[model samples]
Target chain A: MLKYTEDHEWLNLADGVATVGITNHAVEQLGDLVFVDLPEVGAQLAKGDAAATVESVKAASDVYCPLDGEIVEVNEAIVNDPSIVNSDAQAAGWFFKLKLARPADADGLMDEAAYLALVG
Target chain B: MSDTTELGKTPLTALNARIGGKMVDFAGYEMPVQFPEGVMKEHLHTRAKAGLFDVGHMGQVILRAKSGKVEDAALALERLVPVDVLGLKPGRQRYGLFTDQNGGILDDLMFANRGDHLFLVVNAACKAQDIAHLRKHLSGDFEIEELTDRGLIALQGPAAEKALAKLNPDVAAMAFMDVKDVTLAGASCIVSRSGYSGEDGYEISVPAEQAVELTEALLADPDVHPIGLGARDSLRLEAGLCLYGNDIDTTTTPVAAALEWAVQKVRRAGGARAGGFPGADVILPEFERGASRRRVGLAPEGRAPVRGGAVLFADETASEPVGMVTSGGFGPSVDRPVAMGHVATSLSEPGTRLYAEVRGKRLPVTVATLPFITPRYKRA
Candidate 1:
């Protein structure tokens, strides 16, 4: 199931792991992305922790992790071409994959419907 | 202060909306911060081709001499600023700063001697204060006429001349800082060969009612794109121009802002018009001695952009800040993060190393000579 955080990050959970990326709404607000800095593999992160930084020409913003986990994989493609996140923020722009510290933690996040209501 | 409060809109507001401008509230005005092309592309486009900017939010006024002599108005204006206004020839413009009794800057402006009168353009946010200042000081000798019915637009870049000359052939003959009245598309206008972008450009002041048509005419050129306030800030920063509120303020003097060049010899000590303007006691001495701190260019070592208000430290690990970054950003033309701010004179030398604490990380920076991108001004 796909879930969203109040911070505008999205998480997809499967097989005790979760894939995370910024939502389309967040990417739209950020405008054109010029640089992306992601956390390295094996880096530990707490829920709501800043795991990446996305920079546009005018400003920089931190992207927080939705749930606590150890980073098992990172999207090196988005790091190399930051604009990809602006073009395809949901799927190909997935920032990192985390081995969930607690499989049930995803339930605490907002589902797609609730997340849309909050953003609206 | 309420979100429901109406923000001031320029004459080009509707046109901006039609072009898909990303609007934002700036200094109480609903202005476009950027367009769909974004600040980076808009900035690079201005450096490469021509860009049309709606500068109508700037305050334009005419100071007419009550006694029918231009010197009367010049002398009245000289009392507020340190620049030598009496020496300004007809059709020529000069950059000036309004100084307080303490030698601090009140506002920076461009004043053009229009033969019989003086034309002044000041920052929009400070317009009320500037006009009131002029009235309080010079109302006795000058009639200050606020040109609220006019609009201002700037055509800037390497291709600016080529683009503008197609519509007004007289623009090709105008030299830098030259201001003259011309007719564009049958609309009487005042065109000045000067701008804040540090490029060879022209600022056209037109009738507010005809601003849309004039803007549309310029935008018809293939080289000209509608640039917004976002690229405008970055472009001026790259050129080392000072934004009144960001780079300079009520506490900063022309000497401290590295704007002593704007102060002519006649206004300095031992000159013909010495000590006549406000704060001469403290400002004139800075010419002989020096200011304790000066504004200088800062080039960050890496890609992480350090924005304004970032505290600067003397060493990488030092907690005490020696200065602050007044204006910092990514320079699209330079392809790096460039900044400018005040620093102790001891640390103001080019190539001097310093550290800026950006997002809790200490980033290395070097004090470099200004104009991160060299100005491509056309001089006669």
Candidate 2:
């Protein structure tokens, strides 16, 4: 299931794990991504904590954790070449995977249609 | 810094918006932050070929001596700045700084000797204040006329010569720091072989009415791409040029900003015209003894871009900040993070190691040389 956060993060939930990445809207606003700083794979994170950083040629911004979870896996491809995220932010540019503390919390997020409305 | 007040528009605002420019409020003017190509590409494009920028919002003014001599105006102007204005020959422009009475920089500007009159271009945000300052000081001796109806555009990069030379053949003969009156596409323009970008280029000042026509004509050349404010800042930063409010301001002195080169020997302590300018008492001594703090280049260890206001420390465990970053970002040409800041003069040498606090982490940085990239100005 796909969901989005008001902070411009997207989640793709599968079983108890979810793949997290910033939305395309955030990519457009931040301009070209020059660097990405991600958290360790096994770190524990609370909702609203800064989990990652996305830096452009102009400025740097924090990518927040949408839900309390244990970080399961982190993507290293974008770290090597951050422009991968700028080119394809949703799929190949996914930042990390987290084992959710409560799987049911995904229902609280906005769906694709609601997320589009929020951004609009 | 807020948009509550009415925003001012440059002569090329409509054209900028028409070409997919992301317009934002910059110093009260609705300026283009970047175009559809984005800042990264625009910056790289300028370095590779040519990029045209609309700087019409910058303040342009003319200073004429009431006594009918440009030397008199230059001498009167020298009372406020620490530069040798009288020594500047006709058709040459020099960088200047406006100093307050107590050894602080009021503003950094460019002044050109345009034969009978002196042409001055000041920062947009400080223009109104600077005009008031000049009027308060030199109105009785000089006639100051602000050129509100002029449009300033910079055509920059290695290929800039090829593009502009197509319109005016004489431009190819000009060298760096040379300012001349030239005609382009039927518009009478003041062309200067100088720009913020470290590339070989020209800044052409045209009449407001013909601004769009000149901009459009330049873009028609294959080598020319339209650039925005985003690339402008990056280009200048990579070139080690200081932005007025960020690098040097009302609080920083010229010697502290590492701008002693602009102060010619004639204006220094032992010269004939020394000790006449504002703050000469405080600034001149620094020429021999030096300032306690100095501006230097910085290279953050990794890819994370360290930006303005990031506190710098001697080490990760240091409590007090040793200095602070004044201007910084990813240098597209350098292909890495680059920065500049003021640190204690003791640690200002190149190769000195320091740390910048970023996101609760101390990122290691090295004190490097200025102009992250080698300048390609046609000085000869």
Best by TM-score: 2
Instruction: List model 1 lDDT by residue over B186-210, tens digit each.
Output: 7799999999787999999999999
Q: State the TM-score of candidate 2 restricted to chain B.
A: 0.99
Worst 10 residues of 2 chain B by lDDT: B1-10
Misplaced by over 4 Å in model 1 are A40-42, A110-120
DockQ of candidate 2 is: 0.90
How does the DockQ of candidate 1 come out?
Answer: 0.59
Candidate 2, residues B247-314, lDDT tens digits: the string is: 98877778899999999999998898987878888899999999989999999989889999999999
Candidate 2 versus the native: TM-score?
A: 0.99
Runs of candidate 2 exceeding 4 Å displacement: B1-4
Q: What is the model-wide C-alpha lDDT for candidate 1?
A: 0.90
